[model samples]
Target: MINRRIMMTSLAAGLIAPAFRSAFAQEWKAKYPELIFAIIPEENASGTVERYTPFCAYLSREIGTKVTLRVVQDYAALIEGQKSEQIHVGWYGPASYARAYLTGAKITPFVIEVSSGGIKGYYSVFYVKKDSPYQSVADLKGKNLGLVDPNSTSGNNVPRFVLDKMGIDPDKYFNKVVYTGSHENAVLAVQQGTVDVAANWWNSDDDSNLTRMAKKGMVNKDDFRIIYKSDIIVNSPIAYLDSLPEDLKAKIKQAFLEAATKDKDAYAKLSDGKDDPFQPVDHSAYEPVVNLVKFIDGLRKKNG
Candidate 1:
């Protein structure tokens, strides 16, 4: 009877141990479902949600995990989320990427938007009404100008840097400067004559901005003229948490690159058909933006 009892006890231990191990493994695999992504709000709150929710669903499917997308009020809040690790991934403009990266966020990939010359960067274009007296960047001196956002690359950073290089001080050069919070809002402000000039991101000879305004019947093609264009600025990047697991990071990178090529519809929806999905990237590619930030910071300090 003792020998029979010992054999049964050993068999029971073997059966229960494997079940406990399997449960622990499952719990580990399920952790990614808790990750949340952060995006900046550029348009109306509802419009931003409608545009990005599909992207979250697509990424969730590709990564084989649940993903949630949340739009914080501003770029600063998004950066804060990264610091707190509440946000696992973020799509950030060049300036914001530099800020977050310097603050310890790891930039992993960059979106290559499709344009007239294939995959390329974009420029900041300052525009005025077609009949406006402003003919050049200098003409805007001491005139009211509209800037999209202080943290925006094409909207404010590039434009301000351009002015500083030209020996022009934005605060003193403009009669008044306004932040409209979005590129579209800046464009509308120019069209409506609410401001003499507005800064925005535009592709060279590309119809993206024009088409969008036309779709909404907000402005006509002939109503505006570009006064100045800055050098190309790199497109926004996809950044991940620096402390995420290496194997998981590799999986995420592979998933993004594959989805960009293998899934046309998904790529189009995410990038608004303006670009492909994403390509692998690292910190070195963003050196220019970092320098730009430093230059801007220096100027602000001097003026202050």
Candidate 2:
């Protein structure tokens, strides 16, 4: 069974009233007692569990259903799970969701993460230790570079696109390019000087992985410096399986919107306090990402 018990700190009290659950919430209780809400394993499974438990709980209470929080092993697990209807609602990365939607997964995006500044997107950033002499992406030539994961939008896809746009092939531009697996790890590698520079996401107007780590007391923002930033990339989106009953999907979307509006702080947590509240979106919002995926795919095919 997918785990429902996720460890997280308590959220603010009285933000969501139990009275707000729709009256029809009980109608499907017998048919679907528990709904599975899965996350793409952007970070370590343990960290995903810790951060998203409260998020899932808030949705559970708002929707008046038991929402089980599950973190799949990788992007493929999540996309396949949604395609198979094993996952109900998914907190998916933009590129992954686009791939899932294009491949005929019955998935529909309804809400996108907004940062504290009312921006619905973020930037892919390349950073180095504060003391490093590098001042630009060109300067990183013949030096180590770190990336998050292959499926990571801000970490890999967008960064690759940005580099190519700058006439740099990551494959040959850097002395060494390493997939560090997670944003936190990429940031950590830069802080620890394991890599000369690493790519990660930052709030377009606010904080980023480094700030998030600082918020956790893991590292200070002053320890690293961002030398290059890609254009705004849409933040990850929350998508629900289209196979779900229409009413259930509506309720799920409404529940999440309400929770995000009332508990904006918790909402901010999703995007490192760069977004405020949440906003509705559709598959079209991610078309650029789909195209980027295609471009990246073309690059890979050419390389082979």
Per-candidate TM vs. native? 0.85, 0.85
User: Which of the numbered candidates is closest to the native, going by highest lDDT?
Assistant: 2
Q: Clashing residue pairs in candidate 1, if any?
A: 142-173
TM-score of predicted structure 2 = 0.85
User: Which pairs clash in model 2?
Assistant: 114-275, 115-274, 115-275, 115-276, 116-274, 116-275
Per-residue lDDT of model 2, residues 74-114, tens digit only: 67788899899888888877888877876789888999887
User: Mind sharing the TM-score for model 1?
Assistant: 0.85
Candidate 2 lDDT (Cα, whole model)? 0.80
Candidate 1: 10-residue stretch with minimal lDDT: 108-117
RMSD of 1: 6.0
Residue 180 of candidate 2: its Cα lDDT? 88
Q: In model 2, which runs have C-alpha deviations exceeding 4 angstroms?
A: 1-27, 41-47, 262-274
